[model samples]
Target: MEAIATQDRITSKAERLRILEQTLIGAGDKGVRPSEIARRLGVRRQTVYRDLRALSNAHVPLWNPGRGRWAVLQDQYVGTVRLTIHEAVALFFAARLLVRMADEFNPHAVSALEKLSLRFPEPVRTQARQAARQMEGSPRNREFVQALESLTLGWIERRKVRVLYRSAEGRAAHPYVLHPYFLEPIAPGLAAYVLGYEETYFRSIVTLKIERMTGARLLDERFEEPANFDPAAVLQNAWGIMGSPDPVTVRLRFTPDVTRRVKESHWHPSQHIEDTPDGGCILTLRVGHTLELVPWIRSWGRSCEVLEPAPLREQLGAEYRAAAALYHAG
Candidate 1:
């Protein structure tokens, strides 16, 4: 009976410690008082203090913020990760790429990079630490952070989210109740987008940029993801994050000068390249929407020409002509 009782006490203590850790983590930088922690966990102040000490001894990075408040140094706490030298080198390079890609501050990214750097040796470690510091210096976007958090919660818990979104067109903010299906990071890494089923407004699956979300709230209403809904399948033909139900085939003729540059990388899964008679190349690919391809097509300048889908060709022609007129007027 004594042994059983001892086991019970051990189990209870372990559970309490787990909950206590979560409570402290959720408290964030402001932290919680010992008295508040005791109240929340239905424990004595002495017990909370004892657990805090145990956690601190276990290297949980708990810190006192005066007024008897306790908080975890969130950024300093990274659970153990074991990596081989090759794996670590790969991660180091990926970290650098992420740092370059990030246009806005993300505390989580900074913390992750800092943690990863600790596992490395010498110069590589120093470089990784510097990369993290650089990211830390970037300006924080509170709205984007909040929206990302809310959408992340919705996606993880299969909950609906209420969002106020403003489009790129600078239109009035519109409200949406979305069932977040996926969170996707778009190219150049400057923006993130949430693909979801809009219960309000669109009444269909739509992609909304996270930066454009002014406000977001996680709803109590939960949802079951459709059995047939496959994110990869949905984005199979996507040029970027936005994909259409119907796809279109696009072909572009690249001049010899840029043909080698274009052929250096695989741009799309559906791409088919053929050498032209004039030492140029004809690149053909299927994409869900021409809209996402416009900027990419324009970036190649006079080195490329859109040969198929007359509508897109005409659109680019009109835009080019308008730009020419502006330059001519100037």
Candidate 2:
């Protein structure tokens, strides 16, 4: 019982500190009264005052007017980095996953996100929290991550590194000079992924999962990339970050029941939405043949219709038919 009470006290203290920081940070140099803090945090005014006192004792750079209001100390407020709604949400979740991927990725990113709780408007913060929950994060591969960091660092420094890699086809293990062009984070575990080409294999951008790197060895070979090497444009036509030279314009129609809900959120940057007279909504996306969009499209079940893109529609139609055949067979 005593230990439980102590734990509760610690939890309460942390909660109060969070309330205190959020109250002051969002105040924007304006002072906040205890009543306001209590109202926002759903606590008593006295509790708010107590939390304020605790914050002051912690040297949080807060000052009380002595009349029962606390304001952040002048010249002590470090302005937070301003972020748009999508940017904050994306950054928060991405940073969180990155930190979890490589243990040494960035310890301070979580702290920064914690600070951003106060930085964002309440609605944006809430929405971002919800958005963060929607991501599909893979398990952290720590051993794979460490090897990636070592090799990527060596590669960027113009040092050649031999990497033992397993291809996606699971055919054979090969050693080649890995040039890490970009880091892609698939899930919560890997900090970021390294993309480069292999000297022993195809010169195309081979994606090396940061968490799957088995071994890395640094070599003494240095060569500068082409002057017009534009990393951003490298995968211009790629679908869902996996760029390919060929892209298709895929069109989909959502059933009346699902159209409104679908319209409430932005599915893709290249999305175009049109409402049908009867009620259904048409969504078209210009993307590569990368299969990333399949899961989202499949989630709607019979409610979604693939319209303009014959290939996508055929693919989905085949899958649905196959599933139906299985049911009938069973």
| Candidate number achieving the greatest lDDT relative to the actual structure | 1
Q: What is the C-alpha lDDT profile of model 2 across 83-115, one tens digit per residue?
A: 887776677666455444544423234345545
Task: Mark the regions of model 1 whose C-alpha exceeds 4 Å error after superposition.
Answer: 1-79
Scored by Cα lDDT, where does model 1 land? 0.89
Clashes of each: 0, 8
Please give, for residues 1-330, the per-residue lDDT of candidate 1 as tens digits: 999999999999988988888888888888899899899889999999899998888779998877778899886675456788888999998898888878889887888788889899878899999999999888889988888989888998899999899888967999999999999987543679998899878988888899999779999999988888999998999999767678999999999999899999999999999999999999999999888899999999989899999999999999999999999996
Q: Model 2: which residue pairs collide?
A: 101-189, 101-190, 138-187, 140-189, 183-193, 184-193, 238-243, 238-244
After superposition, the stretches of candidate 2 with alpha carbons farther than 4 Å from their true spots are 1-142, 187-192, 328-330
How high is each candidate's TM-score? 0.75, 0.57
Total residue pair clashes for candidate 2: 8
10 residues in a row with least lDDT, candidate 2: 130-139
Ten-residue stretch with the least lDDT total in model 1: 74-83
Q: For residue 163, give model 2's deviation from the true position in Å.
A: 1.5
**Highest TM-score against the true fold, candidate:** 1
